[model samples]
Target: MEALEARVEALCEQGNALADLEDHAGALGRFEQALALLPEPQDSHPSTLWVCVAIGDMLFLLERYPEAREFLRRAVALPDGLGNPFIHLRLGQCAFELGDKRRAGDELARAFMGAGDEIFDGEDAKYLQFVRSILLPAQDA
Candidate 1:
C-alpha cells in the first residue's frame, strides 16, 4: 500500500507537470493512472480530490462534457472539493456545455458568490470572469 501511495504521488506530480506544460492529454493519462491506484469510491481519500479535479478539468478541455460532469460531481462531493471555487466553476462550465442551463446557472452562481471580493489570479480568474459574463447577465433577465 505504501508503494502504491508513492506511485500515486509520483504520478500526480508528473500529471501536474504535464498540465503545466499544456500536455493535457498526457496529464489526463497520468491522473487516470493515479486515480486507479487510489481507493475506490474515493470520497474518503484526500489525495483523490485533486486527481479527480484534474481528470474532470482535462476531460472538459477534451470536450467530454458528460464525463467531465461526472468526475467534477464526484470531486465536489469529496470533503476537500466543496470549498474549491474552481470545482464549482468547472462544474458550471460543464453544465453549460451540456446544455443543462439550470445547473449551469446554479453552479455559476455558487462559484461567483463563493469568490466574494477576492481577486482571482490565473486560470481561476478567467473562470471567474466566465461565470460573471455568463451568469450575471442571466440574473438580470
Candidate 2:
C-alpha cells in the first residue's frame, strides 16, 4: 500500500488545485479519494478531524448537503479541542440551503465566532456575510 501521508498529501494538492479552478466535481473526487485513504477513527490518528473538514467542504461545494453534514458532524464530534470552524461554516451553509433558518443562524454564528479574522478572505466570507445580513433575516420574516 502507498504511504498514507504521501497519498493524502497528493490528494489534498489535487483537490486544492481543482477547487481553485472552480472544478468542484473534480475537487470532490480528489477529496473523496483522500478520505478513502484515511485511517479509521482511532486514538493514534487524530488528524481525522482535518480530513473530515476537508471532505465536508468539498461535499458542501458539490451541493451534497447530507453528506457534508455527516462529515462535518463527525469532525465536530472529535474530542480534541481542535475544532475546525470551517466545518461549522460549511454546515451553516448547508443548513441555509436546506431552509433551516434557525439552525443555520446558530451554526453560522458559531462559525463566525470560531473563525474570527480568518473568515474574511474569500467568497466564503462574502457568502457568510450575505447569509448573516440578508438570508437569515429574510427567512425570519
Best by lDDT: 1
User: CA shift at 30, candidate 2, in angstroms?
Assistant: 1.4
**Candidate that would win on TM-score:** 1
Q: Per-residue lDDT for 45-129 in model 1, tens only?
A: 7788988999998998888989999999999988878868778878988887788877876787787688853523544454466
Root mean square deviation (Cα) for candidate 2: 4.4
Worst 10 residues of 1 by lDDT: 117-126
Could you tell me how far off, in angstroms, the CA of residue 28 lies in candidate 2 after the best superposition? Answer: 1.2
RMSD of each: 3.4, 4.4
Model 1 residue 100 lDDT?
82
Taking the tens digit of each residue's C-alpha lDDT, what string does model 2 give over 1-141?
358888888998898899899898898788778877777653246556676777788888788898888888877777652345677777778888888878787777776778764664564565567556743565634
Count clashes in each candidate, considering only residues at least 3 apart in sequence or on different chains.
0, 0
lDDT of each: 0.82, 0.74
Q: Would you estimate the TM-scores of all the predictions?
A: 0.81, 0.75
Candidate 2 error regions (>4 Å): 42-44, 79-83, 116-121, 124-141
